[model samples]
Target: MTIRESKRLWMACGVGLLWFLLLLWPMLGIKPDGLEFATTFKVFGYVAVAAVFIMFFYQVKEAGYLDSVGKPVKGAAGALAAAYEKAPTWLLLGIVMAGAIVYPLVTERYAHDVAISVLIYVCLGLGLNVVVGLAGLLDLGYIAFYGVGAYTYAILSINYGLSFWLCLPIAAFIAAIAGCIIGYPTLRMRGDYLAIVTLGFGEIVRLVLNNWMSLTNGPNGILSIPRPELFGYEFRSLSSMYYVILGLAVVTILAVYRLNYSRVGRAWEAIREDETAAELMGVNTFLLKLLAYAMGATFAGFAGAFFAARMKFVGPESFTFLESAMVLAMVILGGMGSIPGVILGVLALVALPEVFREFELYRMLVFGGAMTLMMLIRPAGIWPAKRVGRRSEEAE
Candidate 1:
C-alpha cells in the first residue's frame, strides 16, 4: 500500500510482462516468410491487461479495501466446511458413488470416453500415490508397469485365446514382479539419484517394448485385445466399458484406503519420515520398500489391463515417460497421499485438456499457464493430505 512497495510491485510486473513478450514472440511471431509482431502483441496485450488487473486487485485486497466484500464469502465457506465435517462419511460416499454411476447414462459417447480416461488415470494416480505419496519413493518409470500390464494382457488374450478376466491377475502379478526388479537396486539411493534410476528403468521398459518385435510387435502394437467379459456378455459399448473401469477404480479406492490406515501404511510413513529411524525400530526397510513398489505396480497393472481391454490395443508410445510424468503431476496437483485429492487431480488434468480442445493451438499454452499459476498459488496442492503428527518446524 505504501508508495515504495507499489513501485516495486509495478516494476516486477513490467519486467515479467517484457520477459513473457520476449518468449511469446519467438513462438507465435516467427514464420518462414518473415517475423511478425501483430499476433504476438495482441496476445501479449491481453495477458498484460489481465496481469495488471490481478495485481491491482491483490493490492486492494492486501490494503483491506475488499474486506467488506470478502467477509460474507469467507463466512459462507467456513460454514460449508463445518457442515462437511459434521456430515456422515457414508452419506458423502453415497453421493459420490451415485454421481459416478449415473455419469455414463447421462453423457454422450465422447463424454463416456473422457470419463473412462479419467477413471483410468484415477487408478494410475492412486497406484503412484502409494510409492511417491505413502512410501516416499520417487518413481519416474511407473508407466513401465502400466505397459507391462497392458502388454501382458494383450499377448495373453491374442496368443493363447485367454479371457480378459483371467489375464487381469496374471498381468498384475507380472507388473508386481517388474516393480520388485526396479525397486531392488535403488534401495540405498534417495532423492535425485533414485529419481534418475527409476527414470532409466521406465525408459528401459519402453525400449524393450519398442525394439522387441517378437513379443511387442516393435511399435506396431498388439491389436484386437478383447473387451472384458462377464459370463457370456461382452462390454462392447462405451457405457458398458465405463462401468467396467468404474468397478476397477472402486476396487482400487477400497484397496488403497485400507492400506493407508493399515500397519503397513504406518510403517511406510515411518520409512518416509526417516528410513534410518524406521530400521532402528525394526521396520524391515528392505522388504517394505519392495512391497511398496509391488503394491503400487499391482494397481497400475490392473489399470493397464483395463486400458488394453478398453482400447483393444497396446503400444510402446502409450507408455512413454510423458505419461508417467502426467500421472505423477495428477498425484502432486490433487494432494499427495490423499485418495480424494488424487482423484480430483486426475479429473482436473484429464478434463481440462478436453475442455480446452476448442482452443486448438493455444490449449497447451493455457494448460501450462494454469498449472504454473496453481503451483505458485497452492504449492502444497489443491487438497493436501492431513498429517497425523506435528513436525518439528510446526512446534511453537
Candidate 2:
C-alpha cells in the first residue's frame, strides 16, 4: 500500500479504538436504575463489533473501493432528483398537503404527538431561517422570543381572561418587539460577536423568568394554562390539538413561503450575501435586519403560544440555550434558506429521537456524530439552495 493509504488505515484504527474506549464507561460501566444488562458483555461486544465495522469501512474508503460501490447510490439519487424536478409543483404540493391532513387520522397517538413536535420545530426553523438564512444574522437567543410568546399567552390568559386566538397575535407582537429591542442594539455587530450578544440576551431572558417570582412564579412555572378553543369548543384531546397545530403550521408555512419570494425577501437575501453591497444598492440595511429579526420572532412566538396551550403549562426551563441550539441545528441540517429542507430537518431531528427512545441517553452522541459527518460529507446541506436561472426564482 502507498504511504497515504497506510496512514489512513492507522488513523481509522486509532479513531475506532478511541470511540470504543471512550464510550465504555457510559455504555457498560454505569447502568441506569432498575435496568438489567442481561449479559455482562452484551454492550461491550456490540461496541467491539461496531469498532471493527468502522475500521473496515474506513480502510475501504481509504482504498477508494467505496467509489465503485457508491456509484449506483449516486445514480439512484440523481434519478430521484431529476424525477422530482420534472414533476409538476401543484402535484407535489397536493400530495404533501393530503398526507399531512390525514396523518393524525392514520397514525398512532405517539406518532401524532411526535408529528406535532416536528411541526413546532418546523415553524421555529422557518422563523429563524429568515434571519440566519436570508439576512445572514446569527441569533443564538431565538428561543428567548419563543419564551416571550409563551409567557405572553400565559400571563394574559391567567390575568386578563383573553382567549387563545386573541393571545396569539399579542404573543407574536410582543416577541417582535423583543426582537426589535435586541436587533436595534446589535445590528452593527456580525459573526461571532453577534452570536455572543444573542446568547447573552437569551440567558438574560431566562434568568428574568426564573428569578421573577411575582410574574413568572420562578422555577415552579405557571401551570393550568388554558387550552385553545375553536368556535367555543375547547381543544382538550390530543387529536384535537394536533389538528389545531396542523392548521397553524400550515398557515405559518404559507406565510413564510410567500414572504420568501416577496421584495423584502430579496432584500434580505441581498443583505445576507453582502450587507455593504446591498446597502450601496439603496437597501436600508438596519431597518431590514430589524424587520428580519422581528419577522422570524413572530413565527417563533406563534409556535411558543401553541406549545404553551398544548402543554397547559409555561416553564422557564423549556426555553434555554440548548433549545436554541437544537433549532439552529435544524436550520443548518436541512439547508439554510430552503423551506422544504428545513421541514425535512425538523422531521429527522425531532422524530428520529422519539422513534429511538430506548437509546435516549445516546442522543447527543448520535447528533454530534451526524453533524460531524454532515459537515465533512455535505457541507452545503441535504438540499442546498441552488442559483439556477429564472427557474430558481419560481421554484423557491
Candidate 3:
C-alpha cells in the first residue's frame, strides 16, 4: 500500500480506539452510586471488538467500496425525481394525503407518538424553511416564538379556562407579534452577527420563562392544558391526538407548498439570493423579511400550541437552544429549500433514533456519524432546491 493509504488506516484505527475509550467509561463504567470496574472491563472487551470492525469498515469505505454502493442509490434517487416530476401533481398529492390520514391506523401507540413528534418537527422545519431557506435569515431564536405560543396556551388554559380552539389563534398571534418584535431590530443584520443576536434572544426568552414565577410559574412550568375538542368531544385517545397532529401537519404542508409557488415566496427567494439586488429592483426587502418572520413564527406558534395541548404542559426546559438547533438541522439536512426533503429529514432524525432505542446511549453518536457521512457524500443536501432556470420580470 502507498504511504498515504497506510497512514489513513492507522488514523482510522486511532479514532476507533479513542472513541472506544472515551465512550466506555460513560457507557458502562459509571454507576448510579459508584464506579463499576468489572462491568467497565467487560464492556471494554466488547467495545474493542466493535472498534476493530469499525476500523475495517472505515478502511473499506476509504477504499471506495461505499462509493460503488452509493452510485446505484444516487441513480435510483435521480430516477425517482424524474418520475415524480412527470407524474400528475394532483394524483401525487392525493396519494400522499391519503397515506398521511391513515398513518395512525397502521402504527402502534408508541409509533404513533413518534409520528406525532415527527410531524411537529416537520411543521417546525417547514416554518423555519421560510426564514432560513427562503429568506436566508439565520434565526437561532426561533424557539422563543415557539415558547411564546406554548406559554400563551398554557397560561390561558390554566387561568382563564379557555378552550384549545380559542387559544390556538391567540397563541399564534402572540408569537407573530414576538417575531415582528425580533425581526424589526435585526432587519439590517446578516450572517454570523444575526445568528448571535438570535441566539441571545432565545436564551433571554428561556431565562424569562425560567425566572418569571409570578406569570409562568417559573421552572415548575404550567400544566393541565386542555386538549382540542369538537362538539364537546375531547380528544383523549392517543390515536385521536395523532390524527389531530396529522391533520395539522397536512394543512401546514399544503400551506407551505402553496406559499412556495406564490408571489410572496418568490420575493423571499429573491431576498435570499441577493438582498441588495432585490432591494435595488424595488422589492420591499424590510416588509418582505418581516412577513417571512411573522409567517414562520406563525406556524411555530401553531405547533407550540398543539404541543402544549398534546402534552398538557409547558416548561422553560422544553424551549432550549438545542431545540432550535435541531429544527434548523432538520431544515438544512432535508434540503434547505425542499419541502419533501425536510419531511424526510425530520422522519430520519426523529424516528430512526426511536427505532434504535435499544442502543439509547449510542444513538446520538450514531446520528452524528450518519450526519457527517451525509455531509461528505451530499453537501448540497439530500433534496436541494431546484434553481430556477430564468426569472420572469414579474418575479424579479
Candidate 4:
C-alpha cells in the first residue's frame, strides 16, 4: 500500500483502541471520591470531547474529504511508526490546554492558591529552560534570584510602604543584578563544577537571608506581603489571583517564545552546540552566557515577588537548593530546549503527587523510578528536537 493509505488505517486502529485503553484504568467495583467526582468528571469530559472532535477531523481528512495536495519515506511501517510516535504527544497537548482553561470552571472553581502555585512554576520552568536547556548552563542557584526578588519586594513594600505594583520593576531589576553577580564569577566553569558552584551560591543567598536579621528579620520572614490590587478592585475572591497569575504566565510564555526564536536564541543554540565554536564565530559567548543567566534569574525573580505577594508570607525555607534542583529537573525531564516539553514536565512532576495521593509516602521513590524508566525508554527526552533523517535506497 502507498504511505498515505497505510497511515489512514494506522490512525483508525489507534482511535479504535483508545476505548480499550480507557477501560484498563479499571471500572469494576471502583470507589469514587463523591465530592471531587463532579470536578474530575468535568475535566475528563472536556478532554474526551476534544479528543473525539480531533479524531473526527482526522477521519474526515483521511477519507479524502479534506484535500491534502502534499505530504515522507522509510516505506509504510517506518513512516507510519514515525507518525504514531508524534501523535500521542500532540494529542496530550490538546488535552492539557483544554484542562488548563476549564479547570477554574470546575466546582470550587476558584482554587486561586492552587492556580497561582502552578503558574509560578510555569514561569520558573520557562526561565530555567533558557539557562539549562537553551544555553547549556546548569544552574543550581536559581533560587537566589527568587530570594532577592522576594526580599526586594518585601522590604520595599513593608518599610517604605511602597506599592507592590511599583515594587515589581524594582524587584526585577534587583534580581537581574543578582543574576549578573552570580553569573560573572561562574562563567569559567562547566558541568559538575558549575553545578557545585551554583549550588553553593544558592546556599549563600539563603544563609544571608537567614542570618541578616537586621535586614530580612531573619527566620521570621516577611508577613502580609501585599497582593495585587487591580484598579482599586482588590481581589477578595480566589479567582482574582488566578487571573493575575494567568496573565503573568501568558507574558512569560510569550517573552520566552520570542527569545527562543530571536538572534539571541541563535547565539544560545550555537553555544549549546559548542561553546568554543560559538565564541570563535563572533557570538560573544561569555556575554551571551551571562545574559542567559541574568534573564533566566529575572524570570524567577518576577515569579518569586509575585509568589510572596500572593501568599502574604515568605521565608528562607521556601527558596532552597531543592527548589532549584526541582525546577531544573522539570526542564531536563521535559525535553531540554523544548518549551512545551518543559511545561509537560512541570505539570507531571507537580500534578502526579496530587493525583496519586494514596502513594504519598512513596512519592520520591516513585518519582525516581519513573525518571529511571524515562531515561531507558526515551533517552533523548520526552520531546526531542526532531527526528534524525536517514539515507534511503532511492537516495542511494
Q: Model 1, residue 393: what's the lDDT?
A: 85
TM-score of each: 0.97, 0.89, 0.85, 0.73
Cα deviation of 260 in candidate 1 (Å)?
0.6
lDDT of each: 0.94, 0.88, 0.88, 0.79
Q: What are the RMSD figures for all models against the true structure?
A: 1.2, 4.0, 4.2, 10.8
lDDT of 3 at 185: 91
Better of 3 and 4 by TM-score: 3
Which residue pairs show collisions in model 3? none
Who wins the TM-score comparison?
A: 1
User: How high is the lDDT of residue 302 in model 1?
Assistant: 99
Tens-digit lDDT track of model 3 for 106-164: 87889788888998998899999989998999999899988999999999988998888
Write candidate 1's Cα lDDT for 1-396 as tens digits. Answer: 898999999999999899889888998999999989999999999999999999999999989989999999999999999999999999999999999999887889999999999999999999999999999999999999999999999999999999999999999999999999999998679889999999999999999999999989999999888998898999999999999999999999999999999999999999998999999999999899999999999999999999999999888999999999999999999988999999989988998789878767777777788889889999878899899899888996
lDDT for 183 (candidate 2): 86
Model 2, 85-167: lDDT tens digits are 99999999999889988887888888878888888898899999999988899999999999999999999999898999999
Tell me how far the alpha carbon of residue 13 in candidate 2 is from the true structure, in angstroms, after superposition.
3.6
In candidate 1, which residue pairs get closer than 3 Å at backbone N, Cα or C atoms, i.e. clash? none
Candidates sorted on lDDT, descending: 1, 3, 2, 4
lDDT of candidate 4? 0.79
